[model samples]
Target chain A: MISSSRFLPRVSGLALFLFLVVPAPSLVPARAADPAEIRIGYLHLAESKQQPISLLDEPTDDDGIAGARMAVEDNNGTGRFTNQHFSIEDMRLKPSDDAAAAAKSLIDKGILLIVVDLPPGMVLTAADAGRASGATLFDAGSSDDSLREEDCRANVIHTAPTRSMLADALAQYLAWKRWQRWLLVTGSHPQDALYADALKRAAKRFGSTIVEERIFKDTGGARRTDTGIVQTQRQMPVFTQNAPAYDVLVAADESNVFAGYLPYRTWDARPVAGSAGLVPTSWDPAHDSWGAVQMQNRFIKLAHRRMKAIDMQAWTAVRMIGEGATRTQSADPAKIVAYIKSPSFEIAAFKGQKLTLRDWNLQLRQPILLSDGRTVVSVSPQEGYLHQTSELDTLGYDRPETKCKLN
Target chain B: MQAQLIRRGRIRRWPPLWLSLALTVGATSSAFAYTAYVTNERDNTVSVVDLDKMQTVKTIQVGQRPRGIVISPDGKFLYICAGDDDIVQIVDTKSQQVVGDLPSGPDPELLALNKTGDLLYLSNENDALVTIIDVKERKALAQIPVGVEPEGMGVSPDGKIVVNTSETTNMAHFIDTDKRDVVANVLVDARPRYAEWKSDGSEVWVSAEVGGTVSVIDPVKHVVTKKITFSVPGLRSEAIQPVGIRFTKDGKLAFVALGPANRVAVVNAQTHEVEKYLLVGQRVWQLAFTPDQKYLISTNGVSNDISVIDVADLKVIKSIQVGSFPWGVAISPE
Candidate 1:
C-alpha cells in the first residue's frame, strides 16, 4: 500500500510537469532582433540668387527637408522595433555644387532610401548616383513624369504626384462642371512646355477642346517694390487682354512669375486654374474631416507649424513602415517591404480610403483634393472614370501603360 | 433568590452558542464579496483583481483596442468595444474568450449598455451616427444621425435618455431612446468631448477640449448650468483641457482627467468646485474605478502607462507600464 501511494504521487507530479512545461497554443514565437537598420537620406533644391518672382525664393518650411524630418520623427516613434531609422542629410544643391557628388555622399552615409526635391536634369543625375549606390530614390517635389517614364531607374519610387495625374484630376473636374472650352496659357520655360503637354493630353482624355493657346513670357521685372502692385495691376490686364473666349484660363507657369497676377483680372472674367487657382494637391490644411484634425493637430504640435502636402506624404510613408513593423512584430526590411506590398495591407492616412501604393509606378494612389487656396472644392476621378481594378489607379498611370520596369 | 439562579443558568448556556454564531457570521462577511475586472487597452486583455487579496488573480486576452467595457445585467457576459475592429466583442464571464460580436457601427469609440441589457448605444465616430444594437439579437437596430465627429456616449440613470457629444461641433445631442430622435442639442464649448450624465439624470457634464472647461448642462432645461474652469501654474490654459470625467456612485465627488496637464482634477460635484489636482501620467484620456471606489485607474495615452490613484488619499499609488498608446480603461466592479 505504501509503495502504491508513492507511485501515484510520482505519476501526478509527472502530469503536473507536463502541464507546466508544454507551451500554450496561443503563445506567439519570440521576435528576433533585426540586424540591419534602414536609413533614408534627403536632398533639397532651391533656386540660387533669391529671385523674388521664383517659387523657390520663399524661405518656407514647406519642403522635402521638413517632410523628411516629420517622417523621421514618426518612424522613430513607432518604427523603432523595425530597426528603421530615417536620417536626413540635407544638401541644398547650388548652381555650382555637383548634384551627383551630393547624392554619392548621401549614399556613402548608408542611406538606402533617398528622397529628393530637384529639377528633372538634376533628378536624373541623382537617380544615376543612387543606382550606383543601390539606394532607392523617392522624388517628393518634382512633378515631371519623364523621370518616372523615359529615365526611370530600378531604385526610384516617385512619391510626387505626376503632372499627368494633376492634369487628369483637373480635366475631369472641369469636364464635369461643363467647362469644355479651355484657354491654355503656357509659360516660356521648358518646364512650362512639359506642363502644357500634360494639359493637352488631359484635354484629349476629357474630350475638352483648347479654344486658344498663349505663351506668357517671363518678362524681366522687379517683384516686390513699394509700387510693384500698382505697376502689375496696369501691366497684367494688358498682358492678359483679348486672349480667348473660353470658360477658364489654364495657366502652366512652372515659375509663378506671371500666373500669380492672372486670377481675378483675367481676360474675360474667367476662372483661373491649373497651378494657381483650384489646384489639385495631395493634402490641404482645410481638410479637417475624416479624422484629419487629429493628424493635423499632432503635426502642428510636433513641427510648430502647418503641414504641407509634401510633409503629409512623407508622414504617410513613415507611418506605413511603422504600421507594418508593429503588425508583423519584426523590423526585418524584407518582411516590412513584403507587408507594404501585400494587397491586404491598407493604411489609414486620415484620408477617406485606406491608401495603397501602385505597383506599376511605385506611386502612392491617393484622392486629389482640389483646393482654391481656402476651401476644398471637390475630390476627383470625377464620377464615371472606372478602373478595371482599383479606382485609385485612374488617378495616375495604370499598370498596363506604366513605363516603369523595375530591374 | 429563585429568579437570580434561573437567569445565571440561562446566560451560561446562551453565551457559548451566541459566540459561535457571531464568529461564523464575521468570518463569512470578511471574505471577498467582489472582484474588479480591469480591461487594459494596450495589453488587449482583462485583469481580474480579487479585492480581498488585493492582487490580480487572472488575465485574459480579448479583442483589439478594447475600450468601454461593461458587465451584463445578468453578469453572464462582459461586453467590450474593440474600437479598431468596429465591433462590440462579447466575452463569456466564465470562459473569458470573446465568444461573439455585436453589430456595432464603424469606429465605435465609446459605448453604453442600457440598464435592461437589451440595448447598446455606440458612438460611431467615422459615420457621425449613434448605432443602437439589440444586445440579445446581436444586431444593429437603428443608426441615428448626430453632430460632427460624435464620441463619448452615455446613457442617463433613467436609461430612457442617451447623450452623445460631437467633438468638433462642440455640442451634445440628447436622444430619447424610445422615440429614437434627438430631443435637444446643447452647445457647450470648443471641441466638446466625453459626456457623462448625472446619476439622477438631472444634469449632463461635457468636457470642452480646446476651451479648457467642463460645461454643466441641465438635462431637463437643456441649458448650461455653469462652466467649471481650471488654471494651474506653469501650465498653458489650452493644455489643461479636460477629456474624461467620472463621478462617485453617490455623486458627491468627481474626477476629471486633464489632458497635457498630467493630472486628474478632483471636484466637489454639488459645489462645482475644483478641490485638488492629483498628478498622473502624461496625456490622461480616460479612467475607471474599482467597485469599492478604493482605486481609480487612468489611461495615459502618450505615456503608455496606467496611473492608479488611491481614492482615500487622492494620490497616485502606482504607474503601471502597459502597451503602446493606451487609450481607455475599464475596471470591473469590486
Candidate 2:
C-alpha cells in the first residue's frame, strides 16, 4: 500500500534502479508482459428506496456492487492469460452525500474507470466530475433517456438500457401480438412521467395507440403495512373501471407504487404489461438460454441470490474494462476507451449474442428479455421487427434519432 | 448445393494437420470393423455404436461426466475424460468395457493424442491444466498451467505444438511440447470450447460456443486470421453457437455443431462459406465421422440421441436414442 505521497517518487526511483540492475528473463513471458495494474471504482447510492416486491424479490445490500465484484472475479479469471490484473474499489454515498466528492476520492486513488449506480441527478454530477479527472464513467443504473440523449456526457458510457429501449421492446412485442390499443396508466413520480414519455414515443413509432392516459396519483399512504393489500384490491379495480376498451393495459410506474397491483386486479380482464406483468429488462433470473445457465449458476454460487438487470449491467460495465484491457494489451484508459468506442468492440454477456456499443450514444446494443417474473416469455427485437443495420437497433434509439453532440 | 465460400487467403505450410486426417481417410477405404465411441455425459457411460449397422452394440458404464472421447492411435483402445471423477478412463474397443484408468488431474474434460501415440494430453477443466501422460509408462508426465477452465485439446500432427482452448479466457494457448510451456496465446471469441486443425495443417479452427462464431487461426503466427459467421433462417442469431468442429479428409468441407439451434453448419473449408445447415437433434454438442467416411454421427445433449448423417449426401439418415446428454464422439479404425 503506497499511501504516503512523498514515498511515491522514491519507489519509482527504486523500480527504475531495479530494472537497470537486473536482467529480466525471456522464458516467463507472463511476468515480463504484466506490469499494469488496472483498477476500477464502483460508486452507488448508500440509501435506496425500498422496492415493493414479493419477499423473494427483495434487493440486497450489495445489489449493484456485488455484480461489479463478480465481474472483477471473472475478469481476473481471464486476466491471468492476458497478463493483466484487475481490482475494484467500491464507494457508497449517502442520500445527502455529494457525488462529486466521492468521485474525487476515487480519482485520488488512481481509478480511471468508474461504474455509477445512482439516480439520474447523481449520475450527472459524477459524470461531470469523472470527465474533468480524465476518467471514463459507466452508467449502470440510470435508465433516463436524457442521459443518452441531449445531456449525454462525452466520457460516459451506458450499460443500462434506456427507457426508450425498454419501451420500444415492449411496444414491438405488443405490436407483434396485434395489441394495437393500449390503456395507459402512469404514476405521478417524475421518473414515471419520463417513462411515460418514452412509452408514448414507442407507441407512435411502432404503430400503436394509447386509447387513454390516466395518472395514478400518489395519495399519501404507506403501502408496506398489513392492511395495504385489501386497500389495493378495492382501489385498483375501481380506479381502472371507467377506462375505454383496450387490448392491453400498459403501466409506466417507474416508482413501483402501483404496477405490481394491476395484474390480476384489472377491471377489463386484460393482460397487464410494461414494468409489471411482462417486463422488458436486460436480464432476468429465468433467462436460461444460449449457455446462460452457466453464468446464472456461477452468480448464484457467488451472490447466493437471483441476478437482476442491475447486477448484469454493473457486471457488464466492469467486464468492459477487462475486455478493453485484454484487447489492447494496455492499461492506459485512453487506449482502452478508444478501443471500446471503435466499431470492432464486442463482449458476450450471456445474452445469446455478442453485444456491441452503439457508436452514436455509447449505449450497449442488446436484446431485451421479456420475462413474466417466473419464466422468460420471449426475447425482444422480435422476428419481423427489422432494421437496416441490425435488428437490435429497432429496440433502442437508432443513430439517426440522436441529438447528443459529445464535445 | 452452391457453396458460397469466400477464401480470405491461402495459408502456406508443409505437411500440416493432415497427417492424422490422412491416416483417418486412408483407414476408411478398407472394410475395417470401424466403430464409433460416444460419451454419454450425464449417463456416465460409453456407447459403442456399430457404424455399418448404425446401432449401439453395447453401453459400458464409466465414471461421472464422461465427455471428451478419443480413440487410441493403434485403434484398439479408447480414452475418455470422466470429468467429475477427476480421472481418464480407458476402454477396450474389442470388449466394449472400461479396461483401465489414467492419472489425470481434477475435472478432466477433453483429451488429444500426439502423432507418435507415445503421449496423451488431457485438459483438467477445473484446475486449468493440460496433463501429459506417457502411454508406454502409463504415468503422468507434466502438468502445464493454462488459462481458466481449459476445455479443449488439439495436438499438432507433428507432435510439436499442442493447442488448449480455455472457456472463460476465450483463448487458444499454444504450448511447446519440448519445453512444456505456453509459447503464445491467441484471443478468440467468448467461451472457446473446441479446436480442430485443418487437414493441410495451415490453419486451426476454434469454436466459440457463446460468441456464436468460429475463429480460424494461423498456427505458425498464432493469430486469428478470419472469423466465420453463420445464418440459419428461423433460428435466433444468438442460438447459432458453434461448439465442435471437424473437417473432412480432403480438407474441402467442414462440419460445425451448433449447440442449441439444433443444426449443424456444413462449410467449404477453403472458402469459409457456409454451404448448408443440416437440422439435427436438440443441443448438438460434438461430432465424429466413421473411418469409412460413410456416416457422420452427432451427439445431441438435450435429446439424448445421436443423429446419423450420410456423409455423401449430407442428410440425416437416422436418429438413434442414446443415454442422457451424449457429448464427445470418436470413431475407431479397428
Best by DockQ: 2
> Which predicted model would earn the best TM-score?
2
Compute the DockQ of candidate 2. Answer: 0.23
Candidate 2 lDDT over A1-407, as tens digits, reads 10122212323354436434554223236364544789999999875667664666676888977788888877886776666789889899887889888988999998979999988888889888878779889999999889998999889999999999999999999999999899999999999999999999999999999999999997656657887788788988998998888999999998778889999999889999997999999999899775575567668868989888999999999988888998898889889999889987888887767788988888999989998999999898888876766788997678898988888
Best by lDDT: 2
In model 2, which runs have C-alpha deviations exceeding 4 angstroms?
Answer: A1-34, A49-51, A178-180, A207-209, A242-247, B1-145, B158-161, B175-183, B198-203, B209-241, B250-285, B294-329, B332-334
lDDT of 2: 0.83
Candidate 2 clashing pairs, residues 3+ apart or interchain = B16-B201, B17-B201, B28-B291
- State the lDDT of candidate 1 residue by residue for A144-213, as single tens digits: 8877676666556666788888888999999999898998888998888898899899899888999989
Residue-level error in angstroms, candidate 2, position B289: 2.0
Off by over 4 Å in 1: A1-37, A46-57, A80-87, A320-345, B1-334
lDDT tens readout by residue for model 2, B1-334: 2223222242212223453355356556657457778899878998878765557888999999898998887887888888777778888887778888887766688899887678999887655577788776666666676776787788877778889998767889998888877888899988898989876788899998877889999999888999999988766666778898988989899999998898899999999999999888889989988776767889999988898877777877567778888999998865
Deviation in Å, model 2, residue A60 alpha carbon:
1.7
Alpha-carbon shift of residue B143 in model 1 (angstroms): 31
